[model samples]
Target: MEKILVVEDDKDIRDILKIYLKTGFFEIWEAENGKQAFEVLENKEPDLVILDLMLPDINGLDICKNIRIKYKYPIIMITAKTSDQDKIAGLTYGADDYITKPFNPLEVLARVKAQLRRYKEYWKGSNEKNTIYYKGLILDRNSMHVNLNGINLKLTPTEFKLLEILLLNKGQVLSGEKLFHLLREDEYYSKSTNTITVHIRNLREKMKESFERPEYIKTVWGVGYIIED
Candidate 1:
């Protein structure tokens, strides 16, 4: 059974989510504050987290940032805030998806199912016992590790997925639109090319490549982006 930690301050909402999610396949956990959430994370390491932005102890973004530092588990931010800034902030902090309050229970369940399915597929590929190399970088798909210039590089889940797509189609020019669609398929709610650009920029920075003169991911000037030699 897949375990999930639901962190929300509202007793009614928490109970509602728990009851709906407790069908035979899922083991549900609950926390009303950021502090308790962290404790649950340390001990249980649930397969997914349904997090709320407003917590009594600490900001939910802070918790998300802290968790991203050590863990790559899927996080779905459930909050009342529907602003684009809030959505982007949550994603930037490593959330896999964001759902506004007043959301349908079935919709939330669908999103949860989608995220878990994609995450499982990613890891299953990574465990293939084969390594893929391109542009001086090696991706151990099975271990979910990347090596650049013989030094291991730490990548967020989004970054790893982006690189995997680009590298797998090495030298092929993938437009931002196509990349955005691919990313959205994984539950990232990015609606514009800007989001893809931001993630790619971050990836380049982590790969120690200069944006002014990127070595691997090069902009095609109105065409999209591609991994270049």
Candidate 2:
């Protein structure tokens, strides 16, 4: 069974999430605050993390950043803040998905399943494709890794997926909407295109590409983004 660590301060919310996750047949771990969350993470790396932004001891964004430093496991942030800026901030800090408070437990379960599916697929390199190279950047599908100038790039599953799609469709401009739809499949989490934009920006940063004169992924202004072959 896949293990999931849920770092939520509210005992009620944590219990509710635990019940649902248990029903899903996942091995569930719970942390009532950020300190305990780190304690759990120090010994065990869960397959995924359901982290709340508002923690008592430490900020959840800080926790996310710390996790991203060494691990690339998928992180889904849950919080009461619903603003676009909050969502963007979470994504910028390396969260793969975001959920607001007062959400249905079923929705959370569905999102968990969706994220895990993509995570496993990407990490396992199930596409059976070969390496894709662009200049000095290289993506090895069999190993499910990306390297830039002989240094391995640490990317979240979302960023890796975006880069893989762009490389696969080299020379084609893919709109934010199209890319979101492709990554999310039938899931309609939100209609806003900001999610795609944030992930693209994260990918660019990881590849160390200049925003103004990007040699790899180029913005097509009103169109979309293209990786010229």
Top lDDT hit: 2
Instruction: Compose the digit string of candidate 1's lDDT tens values, residues 169-217.
Output: 7778999888877766844444456668767866887788887888888
The digit string of per-residue lDDT tens for model 2 on 1-229 reads 9999999999999999988988889999999999999999999999999999999999999999999999888999998999989999999999999989998998889888888888887656354567888899999765668999899998888888889899999989999988987787645565567799899988888888999999898999999999997
Model 1 is weakest, by summed lDDT over 10 consecutive residues, at: 186-195
TM-score of 2: 0.95
Question: How many pairs of residues collide in each model?
Answer: 3, 0
Sequence-dependent TM-score of model 1 = 0.85
**What CA RMSD would you report for each candidate?**
2.8, 1.5
In candidate 1, stretches whose alpha carbon ends up further than 4 angstroms from where it belongs are 125-129, 184-194
Question: TM-scores of all models?
Answer: 0.85, 0.95
